[model samples]
Target: MPETVFEVDVDAAPEEQPDPIVNRWHPDVPPVERVSPGEKFRVECLDWTGNQVNNDDSASDIRDMRLDPNHHLSGPIAVDGAKPGDLLVVDILDLGPFPDNEWGFTGIFELDNGGGFLTDHFPNARKAIWDFDGVYTSSRHVPDVRFAGLSHPGILGTAPSHDLLERWNERERDLIERGPDDETAVNHETHDDDPPLALPPEPNEVLLGDMDDEAVEEAAEKAARTIPPRENAGNCDIKNLSRGSRVYLPVFVEGANLVTGDLHFSQGDGEITFCGAIEMAGYVDLKVDVIENGMERFGVDHAIFKPGNVEPQFSEYVVFEGYSVDEDGTQHYKNANVGMRRACLDAIDYLTNFGYTPEQAYIILSTVPVESRIAGIVDLPNTCVTVSVPEAVFDFDVDPDSLAEISSEGRGRAARPS
Candidate 1:
């Protein structure tokens, strides 16, 4: 085990931690600790919502989730000799869940609150609890399926420079002001684009680590929200950032104030349901190094990474396909979002044949090791998207044609909105 430089209690609130856990991004957020080059260490993180959610069978916790103070990151761990224009090389040595707490959750927020990619279709809040058994995880709420998790940090990045931060705030605030357009907001009445087009640097509910009281308000006012993925790679949710992965993060400020948290036990390609991944509090082991002037040498403007090879391997799959058309039959010109949502919905419909309800199928698609891809990008009017779910995950043969009825049974329905 590597030295744990940052640790937080899973049951306690992030603000009550011994070491500060921040949720915003800025150069002056204050580094919790410092590490030398080539040194390996461990970072323990609070769950994305700071454990406001419970392990029980109720979607109420998800329905009332707070997004402002979300994604409580572990640090601004300054690396010695790291400078601007350099690339911070972070090697993800290993990732593991807490021994005492071997369970995690996957949530689908209501349309009014934590809106997701398929918010229009599945508007109500729902949850699935998955218990970890070594590499494999099984959910009691939606039963008869088991698969290995590809553990990874959902949010991780270096701090932004003043200019970069300002640029971010300016553009994002503009988007918020402009609001969602007709295309994105396909439904204007019941299913609104409720979460807003962008989250700006608001002073309300922001945390800036161990900074003094006098500077808290000022710093919080300018700090960027940790929801969207930008040039620095905060909240990309790329599922590929697992153990043994090598991430090259662009450094804007000195020491490359690397802050990371929002760990996930497993996730599908899209994480389509917002808060959909098997959310958990876990520790990540990492080794840090720096590449002098590597950003310019590689012409890198944003964070780039090489994925790990430790993900679970499945031999066969049941592939579903969709086109760039809305559920209402509205045609869009090569829209990937619409296409992916269609693919996911199609899969969900097929899953219902196996005794899973629409909600259970949605949860299964969100938590499993499903693969999503854009099979055709150049085709006009409709871009074909494919979602391939591994057949081995199911106990029974997933041959839709062969099995005409419910061949499997769920433990119980996932918690629904009350």
Candidate 2:
């Protein structure tokens, strides 16, 4: 019999209704049954903005958007028997439409505002308008090719840490106190009547210019360590995180808090345009279960699974920035692509032990490996690489039973926090 995994609806409700689990921060002992390798559960996910936008939308609509504190994720379902330092294995089946009609994801504002690497080139204005058809075709594009710009949530994280929350609270307060930078004397041509402004630079807040290198480094380190994703979940934008591939994520806190809302119908590898995969009212089905004495929590950061091999092949996506030394004793900029090639080579070497011939591996990689993608290159240098190898790839004759065994073993290994 074909193994049947659970399918998450992806489109359910806006999560605007009052359910204790919808927006709360605490973990819950869910009502779902324990999931095995073949068994699956469906989760209904809410839109990122809780269904705040309409079909007839504009840049102003998103710009004036208010992100609510109370408006957070739905399920952090305490996996049955899941303990601290265990990985929550998730199989991403598919991501598609819901009952309602809203297409694409959000978070373009951040990408435009230098929060991401492409901010410099990508226009910070609301470029396109999504209509009722749920398809965003361009009037300027070539004929017959109706390109519907799909988008997904770029930010889906758990609840915030206490210290981080407190720090954020202070930042909010500073913003409220300082208000917009109303310095008319220093205003530039771009400074409109209502120019955007961030929080005031407090002594303890982010270090300003002229701070010592060590101090600056300390600030960056603190931010990286203490700051969880927007909410506590972490910057998890795995588009494949929909519902088929049993995904294993590390458990940082006692309760493996999971916030699922960033829903995208179809997104390209890099999400290059910065605003495809966009949709608001949708649902995600999930079953949060636990693993006993799990050991691969850290490995959750870089999920490694072999397609057919009994000994799972390792796979990881890493971005590297390249700098070449010029003849003038100075460093000249090399393309990020060069750096990506090196990283890809390294990853290939890692997978070689799992049974990939260099040639076979190259072909498999060329076909399956997703390049130029960014889980988050906002802070890192340009080069970004995202790759995945199924456990079955190792076995020439990947039968049903073998597939099951490999999947289960990968899951078992993945469950243990590394």
Candidate 3:
């Protein structure tokens, strides 16, 4: 088995005890409350299927799947005074992958099934399964690559109001009965224009047909809506949400209902497998806190990255880091501005007491946080997003909240090592 080692700055401070109110597990377990800006959590996540399946499983096992109760989430921690029309700011501190597998992968893909662009050519019902050895074998194809799927939760959100949760739960129960063709169940609107490709493919085959074009175009329109962004995370792969970046979610009921089970070791850009990096066992630590009225137009997202690597990681595949200010209102705003650079600075300042110089910071900032864009600008009142990274390469030791205090100009000056 390949050793899943987390390589980065490991000199971060030790964790403190969790708060009782915001620290309790289960959404219904606590009442809702308000959380201040820059609060954070270390969410424990399970495999994409919420640990319903495992590394040693086969396609037959998940084909008729039923998730276990324990696999759902760690909490629905309440943020004090959180109410309607408010955005719940969830800064993702770091996502620790199960060290057993170098990467995590799950089953399922967006366009792979008949629902996506290459539906005509890729007609097989697929299944993605992996073991600690970093070997992945699909439903019908032979294992070829030594890729380990890094697992991250496919679903991470607050519990809707009691009524809303009940309604949605009822709908979920009957989803299988209704089937996919049901008009009420299936609603899709298409559009045009697409994103540019970054880091061209390294001489790969074209056997998958015109999937590239179709995905590029179709993914644009699909990303416009809110619910879908929550469904697949706006084209974000599995192993994101590691270090540096933070995830902001709008609190629905009282407690910011939170849960994370989907785990992935490593994943491709599009998550073409419909699954994430891997499936394994691990514990996700969390520090549930809040941000005041975090909702803003054009949606909100943060950038994440470890100290060694310079580039930033965004909430989804498209958006770049440093696109906006880190509540400090200092970074310049570009027409296609992504806050990746700012986020990287946020990460660096927190992890290393000796911060990077502006020159060193800016150069590395632009390299990462690719596909910069808004994953969801409209979702009723507030929008939520994630900043992602590969766990293998990220590690941090500072409190991200501290970065929000100093002005952007003085972020460097005020950031002194503890």
Candidate 4:
């Protein structure tokens, strides 16, 4: 007989909610529910924005929104037999059409707020509405463009062990101490005071039911805000992790307190400007199991996954290259950000020629799955970064020869290659 499947609704009201949604992963956060090994279950997820912005929301809505403690995730579903030093294997089964609607939005962040690639060129905030029709998405912002749905959970991971938590906190604190002027200082706010953002654990406000004082104190520190991807796999927004994929994450705490959320209907690599993708709330079906001593056996410390059926389809691409040297030949080693910025500008310039405004071009660059590659780093004077957009995404015929010439003509403000 097939294994029994469990269901968790992350958006249900406090009293009615079955599973709790957490903003940060903490080993001490009591599991809302527990599952036996090799169990199948379904989790309903709110959008990355915690459903703060809706389909009808305007660009102004995005601008005024506060995104701190971002990426509301559901459940620290403790596996019955999992323990530290084990590997948690999660098999992604499906993603969804939201609960009430079948639509989502893509957005561009304003320039003043930790700007993204091409932020200087396009400063204004913008949003595009996408209507999902079966397996494809249509956007009004970019007319005559339809692409296959590449849906997946943006955040998936297990809670940190006590040792892992201390290591993270110490490193983060050291970084902040060294650079007091840096804007990325770690916020030390505890999770106790704030009302649960998405779905609070049942019998709310008691995250640690009967844990010892030491465990409770460690949980209070809270794993460094869920922004960057780490060994336990928080916010590793790889777009290829769709249905049928299998992700293996290193287990830290006992029971491998597996947690996930931040479901995206579709997104491109780099997540470019950061404000948007086809952001939507939906359900995810997963099968969970564990591997004993898999971390030591594989010689891998971080999360690794085998993608399902998602792959780039375009045979030919229009490639644009960017260099890191100044016009006067001053070399800036390890300045890949500069190279990436130049590539983005070149992409914007190329898109404008096709009747897209600079803002529209920026939005397209962020929302579309344009591949960015580090073409050459061996060249001493200048390193090369290349951004390639698939020719298939466009309706009109694209001549690679013509685009190559155009890309060379307007290669940002930096000096061209000799």
Candidate 5:
């Protein structure tokens, strides 16, 4: 018998729902429920796109989708005994697809508006409908490839303290003020293209009773958008954080207002492209416990989590290599954004060899699970990145047996070193 303390329903009507789905994580956002430490609870999360998208949505729909308040998060569940400088231990006990219908989607954004890795190669928008059957998911758009589900919450963290929020705002504002000309400014823009700047809270919106109008306004303006991961671990999108994983987060505000959303049925490392992984609406069971003064004991400030029971499938890979150094001898290795783009283009080129057009290849890459790795970074002038696509993902024969093994010996034989 689990000591369940709170429950949230993502599909409920606005008036009927117990907890409000917030677009941002702020300490001022009133918690939907309160629970003592060591209590268990369940959260029902809407898809990353906030249920605005559906299986019937077309590529055009994705292209025209609004970017504000992108991921709808489910909580800020206050822990009774938690406080700043403490640690919150979230034990992920179970994660599964929606009970009514087990379905999800993978999407690729248009290149003009903050595109993904292969933006130049794949400028158009696309989508793949996924059907989750137990532990596996298959997409109708990309047939013959079924991947094991590694469901996990894409966004999970505690609300930042007033000071931390100010620091984040200052740092990001500085980068934005630096303009896009600076090499470091390319992917450092803090907020998404269109933030809900003018959108005020709904009339029925619930807020913390203790806050006044000035405090509410401050919170609304200063709340960090859920785009990038921070010290508190919001929007980390680590796919391995599935059932059985234990996540430790540094507490910032009183009661450690924990929030969670952006459930993904599956995702590859780096989530290379935009619009993100197999976005899904699902139920997550978590056991919340507090570790008093654990941050000082552990000597860490950021979030850390152990891998879940789910393991990535190992198969023969058709590897593609990319370099950050261009023909002009200019190096862009300092920023990973450049390396990701190069690797994506390399992957697109390789996919074209197998009878896939640039568009089709890009869609396949976005929908499929392809591992991206930083192969090397120490080699001064140039940094190396590699994208590994499993040979097993293709139903047709790619002749993996004829390809060189992914080892030094295979490369040595090809070079014929005496």
Candidate 6:
């Protein structure tokens, strides 16, 4: 346990934490603490939604979730002497659930609110409560599934410079405000069933740590929303950023104000369900160093990482494939979004055959360490995507011809909003 720089009780609201967390990214958001290069520190975080969602049967909390003020982050902890043109070297030394609170959640947010990758097929809010036992997690809401947690902070990075922040705002505003036309036809991979095109900053529920009201007044509206991954690596949800991972985050400001939160107990790649990971309020043990002039030295414009050694040990999988085509069978050319969506739908349909409900399967795919790979993105007229699940997660043999299966006769929809 490194020195706990930021601590919080998950039951407490974000603003009430020992070191109040920030929900949006801004260069001016004052750092709550400062650390020298190579210092090891611990940061406690609220769940991504700041305890808004809960551990219960009904998903009414998820359904009524407010979109703004998400991903409440633990710091803008300034790294001493880190400056623009340098790289912030970060090592994810350790991560895990709080011992007393070892349960976490995965949910499909309502289509009208933070819609997921497969929102069209499963539109309403739904949830799965996964309880951790050692490193493995199993959910009461989904059946015949258990796997080791691939825990990681779903989002984290160095703060963007004022200029970089402006660039982010301009880019998002452009995307959110853009209408269909010739340029869109050539460039946009937009789809009706895809995640939101862009998320612009919302000041309505902005949380900017312990910064005074006067500074908050000026920076709130300009702070970048935490919903999308930009150059700063804000919301990548990369599952492999677990223990021992080292990521080089681009520094665009003096002191490299580092922020991290949205801890996950486990997550499949793509995090297809939007709020899909087994999100928990937990702590991250980090050791950070400065790489002066390394951004240019490495030609790095975005956060780059190498995965750590902690991973699920499932060696075999039941693989499902999908191509770039709509549910209506309309043709698409090299569209990974359409292909991935179809692959998820394929997996959902397969599980329903073994007696798991579609909603249950949906949550399984979201929370477990399943592999969602873009098999072929440049395959001419159609892109190919694949979703592969570990054979061992289920209690029964996955081979269709060999084993008995759970009966769908009495099964019902997974947890839904009241």
**Evaluated with lDDT, which candidate comes out highest?**
1
lDDT of 4 by residue, 317-391 (tens): 788887775333444664565576678777877776655667666666666667788889787656698988777
Q: lDDT for every model?
A: 0.86, 0.37, 0.34, 0.67, 0.70, 0.83
Higher-ranked by TM-score: 5 or 6? 6
Q: What is the C-alpha RMSD of each candidate to the true structure, in Å?
A: 2.3, 16.7, 19.1, 7.8, 7.4, 2.8
Q: Put the candidates in lDDT order, highest first.
A: 1, 6, 5, 4, 2, 3
TM-score of each: 0.94, 0.47, 0.42, 0.81, 0.84, 0.93
In model 5, state the lDDT of residue 418: 8
- The digit string of per-residue lDDT tens for model 1 on 1-418 reads 8999998988677778978989899888889899999999999888888888888888898988887798888998999999999999999999878999888999888888877877767888888888999999998887678989888999989999999999999998888777666555444333344567787777887788988977888888899889889999889988879998999999999999999998999998888888879999889999999999989999999999999899899889999998878888888778777788889999988877766778778888887888999999998988899999999888777776656554356323333322
Number of the top candidate by TM-score?
A: 1
Off by over 4 Å in 5: 1-18, 112-114, 180-218, 326-330, 333-335, 399-418
Candidate 6 local lDDT, 164-270, one digit each (tens)? 88998887778767744322232345566555567777778888887889888878878888888888887999999999999999998889999998999999989
Candidate 2 residue runs with Cα over 4 Å from true position: 1-16, 20-40, 67-72, 105-116, 127-233, 253-255, 270-276, 287-289, 296-418
Off by over 4 Å in 4: 1-18, 112-114, 180-221, 326-330, 398-418
Show model 3 residue runs off by greater than 4 Å: 1-42, 67-71, 100-152, 162-240, 286-289, 296-418
Select the stronger candidate by TM-score from 3 and 5: 5
Which residue pairs show collisions in model 6?
A: none
- Give model 5's TM-score versus the native structure: 0.84
Cα displacement (Å) at residue 137, model 6: 0.8
lDDT string, candidate 5, 94-208, tens digits:
8877778689877677776546655545566777778888888877666556767678899999989879877887777775555454354333343454222222222223333
Please identify which of the two predictions, 3 or 5, would achieve the higher lDDT against the true structure.
Answer: 5
Candidate 2 residue 408 C-alpha distance from true site, Å? 58
The true-versus-predicted C-alpha distance at residue 314 of model 3, in Å, is 16
lDDT of model 6 at position 246: 97
